[model samples]
Target: MFTNNFNNFILNTDSYKTSHWLQYPPNTEYVSSYIEARGGNNSFENVLFFGLQAYIKEYLSKPITQSDIDEAKTIFSAHGVPFNEAGWQRLIDKHQGYLPLRIQAVPEGMVIPTGQVLCQVVNTDPEFFWLTSYIETSLLRAIWYPSTVASLSYYCKQLIKAGLEKSADNLDSLPFKLHDFGARGVSSYESSALGGLAHLVNFLGTDTLSAIVAGNRWYGMSEEMSAFSIPAAEHSTMTAWGREYEADAYANMLSQFGEAGKTFAVVSDSYDLWKAIDNIWGGELKEQVKNTGGTLVIRPDSGDPIKVVREALQRLAAKFGTTLNTKGYKILPSYIRLIQGDGINPTSIQKILDAVTSAGFSTENITFGMGGGLLQQINRDTLGWAMKTSSARVDGYWRDVYKDPITSVSKRSKRGRLALVHHQGSYMTVREDELAEQNNILQDVFLNGELLIDDDLTTIRERTKH
Candidate 1:
């Protein structure tokens, strides 16, 4: 979605701008001044420069001139770090130029099956092969989490599609809103944001501001859709002693919202769930809500999710003076939905779908509040993420190799620069090491620090559109 002019920004890989983010204080001024100064003179260092270079060229496209470069030096000198010609020349010699990057995967939102090669990044330059190493953390985090979540999202989609096809009249009426409830469940802020965004691309909702920030910054999803909110309420413990406390809890939850017709989702499994639903919910409140057209979501925190949803829907229907739409034909209640939580994995989710369907509840009238399983269950190791650098020196050949104490096949790193060859629609990793003495035209993605890869998320999305 980035403009063509914006896509032309490229700073040489050796420029201080390239390593700005890696520095302790973050070299924002150097990067900003360099890009503003030498607009057309940008280039990337060795092969690992593809990602950030691509991002700048295809998105920022700021105009830079020699004056900007000199200004950057002035800024550095003012900061007690003198920047000079020799330093610039050393950077140019050591890191200027581009690293070819290759990433292969199923579509971002598509269900990826097991044993797939999620992605691989190979250095295009023999000299700067080490640069490829730093990219693994971010790239793996980016690709792996989404691929796994996409699989689960598709699974949930299938469950809804199947349930809708079974009983509902129009598929369009039931909008499945899958919310990410795992922000606090994960290990770090970065993982929480990225993982939430990945699932949102396939599913529907999230609560993380960081996720929304990333969606707007990277994928252009609007702030409105990304910034959804939910109310907070305190409840008693899941133990038996909470019976005396349950009434006050429900009253307090409703008190905060105050007689409004907005949706209220209360965790219902504390003390006897059936008593809460049958006595408290079904008696005075159900009648009040029925009069006011307010819907109640009985979030089950314990018991089998399949059993809980089945019974909950049955009770809701019975209260409404409606019958189960058996024989795969039924009318859906517009006001009510069976929202569920707790242990919603693929297996548990499948069970809930089946149980609700067998009990004659429209699966479309349900929202899943997924927690740790969706966010933390998927690890980077599952995606087969690897970064291999095959280099081609000034001499005309390539070699691709790696050393591992765990592997038997050439523990020593492969010698030479490598090129990626797409033969018969499959990737054949080729070497550019000097031993072969064969010349193959490399796809010049980076030269003098300019990035050639498409960095716009949509452009990258399109390239995967096979």
Candidate 2:
């Protein structure tokens, strides 16, 4: 959906950012900035770090060319904005079109608490002092989107793990419990690629295929950490048979993909969900579902999440029968299960689980598919993400800088060159100058347009595992 111009870092910032090169102090030589989640509105204490490497590999790794500079010049002039013509020429002439900057960040997939630094940027060359903040538009966006998605996905895992511990047998199904059904619901292809990979960090089930490509291309992953999805029928596939042949549509799904030990899903909400669950699936397809030697997941697409899920589980339990686990919670027989893909979020998921488990059913008897809630339900303010120049060098003098307005104390930002360290088993953002550099947790991942570190999804997943 994008052209090669998408990789041009010169045109990646806001129009106002193009004028900021002229707004700095006359003697400015270097600048340092940091990014963190202030955690005001959302009240999330921790955020999962991700997607920076993908940005670095896709955009920053490439050199800015003459064509990029020409495009930026034309766009900035048309916007009535100041263009850094000489500065652009100098980058191409002196540094071979590479950015003269250094970026240090916490290792990807590690959960760092809000109000702590996750990334820091500094210019390697003093002449390019303004370059640090120039890329904030793209940089902050790159970090926030996937990090927020990963954090949300991570939070859901904690909730599911708690329910599984009390009512389910083992944690084997935890990864597949929350599947990614979010690709079509997001705003763009990049959103799907980024958000899908974030969800993959916590779960192994997904229908967003773009994430698989992103994993292999950006995160250095092969099929080892690839996501899985069962063949599932949507409303069109089911309703295309018309109400008269509704049973035939489900029967076709079993006939085609229902090999031994396989699982397939059919959305059974057309006409009447109860009739599809009771008269059709429970009666006509009962033997096929029971003796097919595989599992059939029943999907209910409409109605209130808690009530609909509880009623569906009860109906399926009565039809197929259930077995009690060691914890005395009833689990659906191995041949059949239920999935609620409609109106799903963490709040609704917990509510549905609470309702079903309260009715003596195990969370293992059902799975959840979250779409927009897992990807598009957030923004920069969701976790209070921001990037500010914490310190700057004026006339070769370095000084701490911060904003502490008397009106809003929550708008306060951190100051000085920062360093992240794990102290007493908890992460802390400290003064890099005051603390030992050897103890710093932030690694130099990018330098002068070169990617210094490459991480695979395997190590990333291990770091994020509960």
Candidate 3:
């Protein structure tokens, strides 16, 4: 809390972002930047536009304020960089403290093919061209990471649903197949909130409290329905009982939450995982678990996910027995299930499902918890996200602009104004002028100071249903 002039900057941005010259062209009278997910190493065929509206409302609505300009002037002058105080002041005076930028984006939750335009940014006023790309740089993290996480979460849901269809009688449990365990693994509270909320668009199970708060605040979700969590235990809780009292720890969990018909999770790997299942849970506490009228989720926190999950399920079934679902697959008893929380990503999740099903168990017996892989273990290139200026109005004439880096062919940028069109049940990128105005999927989400589109979380979730 102490005063430090050195720490005061105009805005919190990347370190390289301090140099303003790096953000814009020398002649930046009017620049148009188009942002897209170019489709890199992701397994999905399409990118989901999920979080742009929230970003626009929270961060981009008011681009620059008088205080921001004054701080920039002070910081830049002290650092011996040319600060455009006049340009910033002009924006504040003319735009009424809002950024004079038009943001056109595909509606949140709509699935658009890779290389299709997700959002486009253009300076509404000719004088603010240099500001467009700078704002894009500031806002890229808001769009790229959330959309990527949403797409990944959506695809993971599809995989889980498919596995459930083959193994379980129905897909009623798909929404809770993958739980968000990424809150602590993310870089910041804001990251956890954004990434957690993105995952919620496809499923509801989450331990990230900030995500629910974000949904209620930004995505128009009521406090009661935004997201949910269940009572769960960590390594500390189980290990705190000491090795000899481990069985008592398992018994205490069931005694607390089992009789009330409430579901809860307990980590089972603090000691010998197999012993906990065989001796403690399956032996001493078996009747308590069966009589609790609630589900006891056993979590395996460490080891090879596929092998550990399959082994844990086999041992649990041996002790608790199994029930044949309507689909003719073997499901565990209603009171017990397995949760694999370690080394769980999209790939490992599929692997675990396959191994468990191959071992004669239904997918319903298992749920997944992903931490870093769901949130922190990604970057802009994960889905090939890029924002490049596609058109610029120079000398009062609009001209197509693009970049074709010799270093990487895939880095080539598009030219002219862009549009996403529905073509043969798929979205396609095309020139804006080539499409009928009504057919263009890109809608004005933010124009000047106004938010044109604010989608609710429920509506966004409904769009993800296939």
Give the Cα lDDT of each candidate.
0.49, 0.90, 0.84
Q: Work out the TM-score per prediction.
A: 0.63, 0.97, 0.94
Give per-residue CA lDDT, model 2, range 1-466, as digits (tens): 2235665688888888888989988989889999998885764778999999999998888888888888778777777989998998999999998898999999999998888999999999988998998999999999999999999999889888989999988989998999999999999998999999999999999999999999999998845758999999999988898889988998999899778999898888977999888887788989888888988999998999899999999998888789999999999889889999999987898898899899999999889999998999899999999999999999878999899999989889899999999878788889999895458988999999999999999889999863
Worst 10 residues of 2 by lDDT: 1-10
Choose the strongest candidate by TM-score. Answer: 2
Model 1 misplacement above 4 A: 1-120, 124-126, 173-175, 227-229, 232-245, 251-261, 323-332, 388-395, 399-466
Summarize candidate 1's per-residue lDDT along 1-466 as a digit string, tens digits: 2222322223222344344234422221110000000011112110111123223342323333344445555545555543443433433455442333333322233222232222334444443333344344444444445545544554565666666777665567333356678888988886676666665554445666676766666555433464454553424432333677676576555555534456666777766778777777676466554544555556767877787778877776666545344445433355445567688876777788777767666666677878788778755443333343323222343323344555544223333344334446343334433325443323443333443443433433333223
- Give the per-residue lDDT digits (tens) of candidate 3, residues 1-466: 2223332224546434456544655565788888999988767788888888778777765556666777776666676767667777887788766778888988889877788888999988878777676666656778999999999998888889999989888888889999999999999998999999999999989999999888988888744687778999988988899999998888888877786568999999997999999988899988888888889999998889899999999999999999888877888888899888899888998899899889989999999998999989989999999888899877777899998999999989999998888888787888887876648888898888789988889989888863
How displaced is residue 330 in candidate 2, in Å?
A: 0.3
Q: What global local distance difference test value does model 2 have?
A: 0.90
In terms of TM-score, which candidate is stronger, 1 or 3? 3
Deviation (Å) of 447 in candidate 1: 8.1
**Where is the poorest 10-residue window by lDDT in model 1?**
30-39
- Better structure of 1 and 3 per lDDT: 3
Using TM-score as the measure, what is the rank order of every candidate, best first? 2, 3, 1
Which scores greater on TM-score, model 2 or model 3? 2
